[model samples]
Target: MVSARSVAVRARSGNVTRRLLTGLAAAALASATALTPSTAHATPPAHSAAVPAHALTGYWQNFNNGATVQKLKDVDDAYDIIAVAFADATGQPGAVTFSLDPAVGYASADDFKADIKAKQAAGKSVVVSVGGEKGTVSVNDEASAKNFADSINKLMDEYGFNGVDIDLENGLNSTYMAQALKAVHAAHSDVVVTMAPQTVDMQSPQNEYFKTALAIKDFLTVVNMQYYNSGSMNGCDGKVYAQGSVDFLTGLACIQLEGGLDPSQVGIGVPASSRAAGGGYVAPSVVNAALDCLTQGSNCGSFKPSKTYPGLRGAMTWSTNWDASNGNEFAGQVGSHVHALP
Candidate 1:
């Protein structure tokens, strides 16, 4: 029993300076063979016509420890308010980024703390985003909440992360969800809890997912509403949020307000890559568009382009690699936007 209080730890190996892996990165890997319902209720969502948020965080999916270290460094160099995601000892299907070597093991929570310290030293705020779409663990009593809390506390003690992100997507809505979030905060007072959920559009509103989220509002930090790739009907509906897609963005804001969550906690999720093959990934939409105009052919894999969504916390990319062509040249474009914000 960790007692849900702060636990300091020592640095272990495989640690970064201050980057916290928040976002639904690992959930993407969990195999979704099923789903179950939870007992909770969320007030219907409502948005404000007056003030739309001015700034929101732009997250990047950096997985595989330092496999994408350079890529992450590139993102760090480019985006100012940067967010990278990591799997809390998870490896399976649809993972945004994960280590394949089962034997590699994770850096001790102390090591993560050190990493967070390093990140803070560099003047960056890092938060650990737990769980992804495979929120399947919550489905079973196999809830890793205890392990999650213990590991997070140890890491917090060592590194002092600004917050912990509770990203339980499609997870089995249960009492466990509240337990895990509250426990983390109880241990760490200043730790922020953010989440990214399925799209809250015309089709998604009917689901009980909103109710599940409303349960832990007190502990919830940011309820990042994704709009990039939101429209497509893929797994998790990757198109749930797309750049220049304000309609969906507004809908998400309305839900946050209706749910009584602070709108400031609402950050919108966007994709840097415009992927193809109906996966709702990030591929070069610009290159694809040029392909559409210059020649007349399928816009699949023909070109590699990056996104430039103006005025928000920042922009997020679907991943670090797709065609092995990123070449660490585009992170600055994304980083500059993040740097520009206060």
Candidate 2:
């Protein structure tokens, strides 16, 4: 999922060797632990009625990534939420633009819109993701924020996207982003807003990305925290979780669960296959175990939740193209499990 970004050598779950921690890093984690918010009794935020139950979300890159190129219509049935990979930010601040990759021959606008309508008819959500690993979009001012909302709205009008995703990997401004989201929601009352933040981005209650989630929680549909590509991070239980272990998924997810997000608004995101990410790929069984542990309190690791979240939203993967390459194992295996959730 970290295409075009610098990748670090990391320990996989099977060969994880412990490393000595510096005093400063230890101290920082302790401070963050103490400051994290509690959501044991927090209520779910009101959201658009368009939100799906236990969604199997996937990203469909406009360009092919080793797999056969797929149009918005070519997405598999296992996916209920399809996020169109990127809408480019123009040279003008906050202005965004999108075009189907020409390498994959283009279809007529009518054909594209017709396919999107069919997906919606069969109960699928289509959205445009705003940034990627190399994304340069930023909203630093009020005018820029307004431009962000306007451009997204225009894309929604043209392509029939149910909403937009905040996948801005470089940086985000909580104030301006919340403003942009509110403006878009105001224009389209049923816009479905989703977020795909990195592991470190949502570890604490006070992180800017966390603040942005809180700022727009009322209308936020889901926050699919990417659980791969991170080395090791502190879970809510004050223990470090290494990538690829069940503990890593369940523990980090607890931070979001207890940090004021509704169970239905939280989802576990992972690479669909070993080739989909550099160092964080896990089997579909591993993803299922994490989901069961979070929602059913079974198949748990060292850090089990005090209570279960049967209402928890389902899983997401980096891209559908990778799942296709893997013979759709991710969607077939995990999608069945997600649909069976209580």
| Candidate number achieving the greatest lDDT relative to the actual structure | 2
Top TM-score: which candidate number? 2
lDDT of 2 by residue, 1-342 (tens): 233211311111000000112343333223221122111112222222355678888988777556556777777888878888788879889878887777555667677778778888887888888887877789877888878887887888777888888888778898888877766665554678889988888988798788888887766888988888878889988999898999999999999999988887899999877777776788999999999999999999888988888878889987787788888899999999988888
In order, the Cα lDDT scores of the candidates are 0.37, 0.76
lDDT of 1: 0.37
lDDT of candidate 1 over 300-342, digit per residue (tens): 2322123221222223333333212344323444334333433
Query: Estimated TM-score per prediction?
Result: 0.53, 0.86
The total number of steric clashes, by the backbone 3 Å criterion, in model 1 comes to 50
**Whole-model lDDT, model 2:** 0.76
Pairs with backbone N, CA or C atoms under 3 Å apart (clashes), candidate 2: none
Q: How well does candidate 1 match the true structure in TM-score terms?
A: 0.53
